[model samples]
Target: MLRLPGFRVASPTTIAEAVAALAEPGARPIAGGTDLLPNLKHRLGAPTVLVQLSRLPLRDVEVRAGALCIGAGAVLADLAEHPLVRAHAPSLARAAGLVAGPTLRNLGTLGGNLHLDTRCRYVNQTPLWREALGGCLKSHGDRCHVVPGGQTCVAALSSDCAPALVALDATLTLHGPAGARTVALADYYCADGTAHTGRAAGELATEIRVPLAPGPRRETYVKWTVRKSIDFPLISIAMRFDLADDAVAAPIVAARVVVGALASTPKLVRKLDALRGQRLDDPATADAIAAQVGAQCKPLPNLPYDADYRRAVLPVHVRRGIAALVAAGENHG
Candidate 1:
């Protein structure tokens, strides 16, 4: 049986009180406790204090001033089923629905998913197993076994929400003892896997603000994993496109093709510039554009799948996304 390391747990009713608790040395703020509890059970993390954010008023989802404001404590199921999310950001809604199982989705908060810990097969083992192997960089050792001679950790970022948020150009507000500040969703993640978050240690995510699209834009999220449900994605893609006319054109305006589960952070493939002004109905054009997209992705070998498999499937996902966007555009027209 895995035992959680000893710690003091505090549940605060207000955000201010929670922030104050987190400001204490060796204290960590937990929302949903999905990620932190597992880590604690495996002895991968040992904090002197665990500050729970469940009582904080951070569970609302509403539209305000042309933007969707989702509180950090909002459950994944709530975000997945929210009418605003379905209408405004269907990609995010789809992604949220595809995360874990119904039970987990009901308990896991959006903030917890956003701040999910980086993972690796070698790192997510029992303490005894890790200790027996002399440990990995993300665990107790100084050297990374995954990269051999590499000094930095190479754990894969397995969150399903990151790519969807990045594709939507969402903004996040973080609160702490020093007050609060907002940042672009892209800035939330660091390139390094071991230290993925750029937020201050004592800070907590307050809300996620996603701007409503002008006109009618279409979005979709597709995840390729070994299992249909209750498993992490092997390669997940979220594509958001602002359609113009029957075909995409200039000021086709904004598009984001984000690839997740293949790296330390969800990668943005900006080469999507090739698809601009291209008609999605033309299979030749779509195939050519997808080829270009596949060329830009560089998948590393990790997790349960091979790098080649992930790379090969990249174009297929892009092609399907374009098809969905075109279908949505036609329906709207």
Candidate 2:
């Protein structure tokens, strides 16, 4: 049985108070606790103080101006059921609904999901198991188990919300003891999985703002995992497309393909630009673009799936996402 290390728990009612608590040494903020609690049990993470942000009124979903503002503490179940989220950012809603189970979805917050710790098969194990293997690069060792002689950590970013938000071009608002700042969602993750998040130690993600599209944009999220439930994605793809009136000349814009769970950060395969000016009806062009995307991804051997298998499925996800978007466009027309 995994045991949680002893720590002081503090619930702050205001964002300011929470920020102050997080500024202290060995202090960490907790929202939902779905991700943090398990890490604590595994001895992967420990803090002298746990600052709970549940009391901070950061759980509202509202349409502000032309953007949808989702509070950081908003639960997954709430976001999944939100009308605006369902209509404007259905990919995000779909990803949230598929996270964990009904009970966890009711408690896990968007911020928690966005800031989910990177995972590695070798790292996410019991202390005894990890100790037996001489620890991993992400934990107590200096060498990466995934890449052998590689100097960098090769842990996989398994967050479901990240790719969905990246596809929508969302912006994140972060607050800290110093002040607040906003950044594009794409900039929130780094290339190194060990230090995947670009957020400062004292900063807390306060909200996520997704700008509304002028016309309805079609989007879909497809995740390939080892299991049907409670399993993190082995390879997740989120694709968004803006359609043209003709539906034959071009898409007006091509789909933004964000591939997750295969790399340190969700990767946007810009090579799919081949589809920008082509109609989805052209099977040859679509297949060519899918082939380009498949070649761009380099999955490593870390997660539950084999690297080659994940690489092979990239085209499948791209094809499925594009097909769904095209069908949605046709329905709208």
C-alpha lDDT of all candidate models, in order: 0.81, 0.83
Misplaced by over 4 Å in model 2 are 246-250, 328-333
lDDT of 2 at 78: 90
Best-fitting candidate, measured by TM-score?
2
Q: What's the lDDT of the predicted structure labeled candidate 1?
A: 0.81
What tens digits encode model 1's per-residue C-alpha lDDT throughout 1-333?
767889999899988888889899899988888778988899878899999888899999899999988999999998898988887888889899999888889889999899888888778888888999888778888877777787877788888998999989999999987899999998788877779987788898999998988765667888887888888888788877776643443245456778888668888876667656555566865587577668777666757678788888888877887777666654531
What is candidate 2's lDDT per residue for 1-333, written digit by digit as tens? Answer: 777899998889998988988899999888999888998899987799999999998998999989999999999999988898988899999999888888988889999999888898888888889889888778887778889898878788888888999989999999987899999998888878789887888888899999987664667788877788888888788877765653533553656778888768888877666566566656765587578778877778988678888888878877876676666654531
* True-structure Cα RMSD, model 1: 2.3
- List candidate 1 stretches off by more than 4 Å: 245-251, 327-333
Query: What TM-score against the true fold does each predicted structure earn?
Result: 0.93, 0.95
Q: Candidate 1: minimum summed lDDT over ten consecutive residues — where?
A: 245-254
- Model 1 TM-score, 2 decimals: 0.93
Enumerate residue pairs that collide in model 1.
none
